[model samples]
Target: MPAPRMSTEQEIEALDEVCQRLAGFEDAISLEWLDGYLTAIVASPRRIERDEWLAKMGQGVFARAYADPADAEQAIKVIDSRFEVLANQLDPELILDDADVLRLAPLMIELSDDDKKQLVADGHIKEDELHLLEQTGEVWAIGFMDATHDFPNDWPDADLETEEGQLFDECMLRVVSLTMEPAELKEVFDELYDGEELTREELIHEALYAAQDMRLYWLDHAPKPPQRRVGELPGRNDPCPCGSGKKFKKCHGAQMQ
Candidate 1:
């Protein structure tokens, strides 16, 4: 047989009991297990519905003795901390391949620009290809190529300047902008012209992690560029700085010696 539905007062009493038991255990425990255990006591097989009186007795013990309420406070904190950990583990970045994206185009076309950008930021879709999913009243279709894709022949060449191309460009820019905060993003923006081979994703992740630690603005104290040393002029018979097989006299010796 099913257990009777708990009344509001009965639920409060049950919650108090659980909270009291939780306060007693100093060690960390799985919140899922604890919730299930509490529910089981009130569930059909056990039918221990009036556990609130037990809870009140526990609370009276807790309140009358301890000089400080640190234990009670910590009990609530641990539950919240466990819940957050679980939530983070459950939600992770999604990876979409070309075919997977194409399949989603119809539903995606209806989403607004902000939502599209959010999807890209969350790793659900590629920034460059998201704008391609534009929708008419009932039709959804691919857009055009952009400078970012280097104008691949996969898409029509002339469509590069059309609404589709513009939309694609806008979404890409928004993805870049939304990937990190301003100061964090600037490191990557600077890196773009620094001639390094680092990928955009790598740079973005580093910047975001730095921002989270509140150390993003620091330059990391890179070693100063080494100074070049001036040397004495070489004689005509000396080895040449040009690294030629011939001595200086035979290799631009007149120009230096």
Candidate 2:
């Protein structure tokens, strides 16, 4: 028998069904800007454009469609996450409905309601809403995603061979945990070494160095509250790094108090 082929029409139809379900989202994003947003996401192999670039690309009307510039930026984030989930699916037409939603669910880290009270008590972040940091992993970006999906790239595998490589892998996790504003994060990832596989031994060394430097740079610049290996941690907002599928506030973070 001949090998099977992926039907492009089916993929398009599956994405169309998802778009249909986002009626409320389109209303939130304003129907006027929705068409342009969808167009840009489906177009190219380049890194997804940041909001600054998208607004410029969309010209004046996209901003006019929203209440304010910040609202428009958030709408762009919602667009980014949804389309990225669709793009990640190779055979979305065959996907389990619940699995897709779970995969596409807003990258959320729930907060401690009590922590919100304490922050107000201590005069830290003023509002409960401020506790929600808008963070998403852009590992779903078109360039990186395409490169990994079609080619063999060793971009993010933890080496099972050596202990030090394992340590570097852990540090790598911390680097990703650091919160970068969405557009800036996408832009930074797009620039992480030309999106190419580094074959040279020296280049691999440099790649490893980049990972190390990334952790250090963010540690110094975006210092988060130190994480605990044990008891009584305080006032933290990041997702638990333990990979337990629970947000930090609901997981190990909850017990810290």
Candidate 3:
């Protein structure tokens, strides 16, 4: 038999009908019912954008959208517990939704390549999954899993609504995380940033390292309280690495306590 046609609109219409029926029975559905409804809708064969669907269902029901695929329930618990730590340490604005969190959970947990494969098996990321890193708030690293180049060679000129554009936006976000400023980070990326122009892994590595160094400079030198890591200590033994002639023990070190 021939394969069935995939029509997203039909699936959407069905969901709408179900929602209408539920609304008729009750003015408002509980969060549990809404979640069950969304899960059933996406678990189907229709390829839907997870974020858009969640927004439609109401932000509360879809909040768990970014849970880790390996241990979805546990991941949510851990994230909530750790969210305050992040807010207190780095920019609280770095907060993410369920879909974004899931997309990034593997990286956050520092999973090995083998573990990543297991996550795929666990449905953490789909086999056809593609991602784009935010290089800066304005520039993204767009690419696909089953394709070449991460983003379009001509980016902004490309149709922003197309799959290519969405991929580009995702990549830009990834790059933003790398640069530590989604919207304003400098674009030090070379043409090689696009896989099509150059695929050397070393080049990509060097580019990221350079971007990190820039972020470090901003964090350390900017007048704000440096976002020092927990247990991180500046060299008290050295010449106060902040370029001051005074010993670190006499300068920044004295403030350490």
TM-score of each: 0.17, 0.21, 0.20
| Model 1 Cα shift for residue 233 (angstroms) | 81
Order candidates by lDDT, high to low: 2, 1, 3
- Give the TM-score (vs. native) of candidate 1: 0.17
Better of 1 and 3 by TM-score: 3
RMSD of 2: 22.4
Q: Which rank order by TM-score, best down to worst?
A: 2, 3, 1
RMSD for each model, in Å, please? 26.3, 22.4, 20.9
| Backbone clashes, candidate 3 | 27
Worst 10 residues of 3 by lDDT: 142-151
The parts of candidate 3 lying over 4 Å away from their true place are 1-73, 77-198, 223-257
- Model 2 clash pairs are none
List pairs with backbone clashes in candidate 1.
Answer: none
Better of 1 and 2 by TM-score: 2
Best by lDDT: 2
Better of 2 and 3 by lDDT: 2
Q: How close is candidate 3 to the true structure, as a TM-score?
A: 0.20
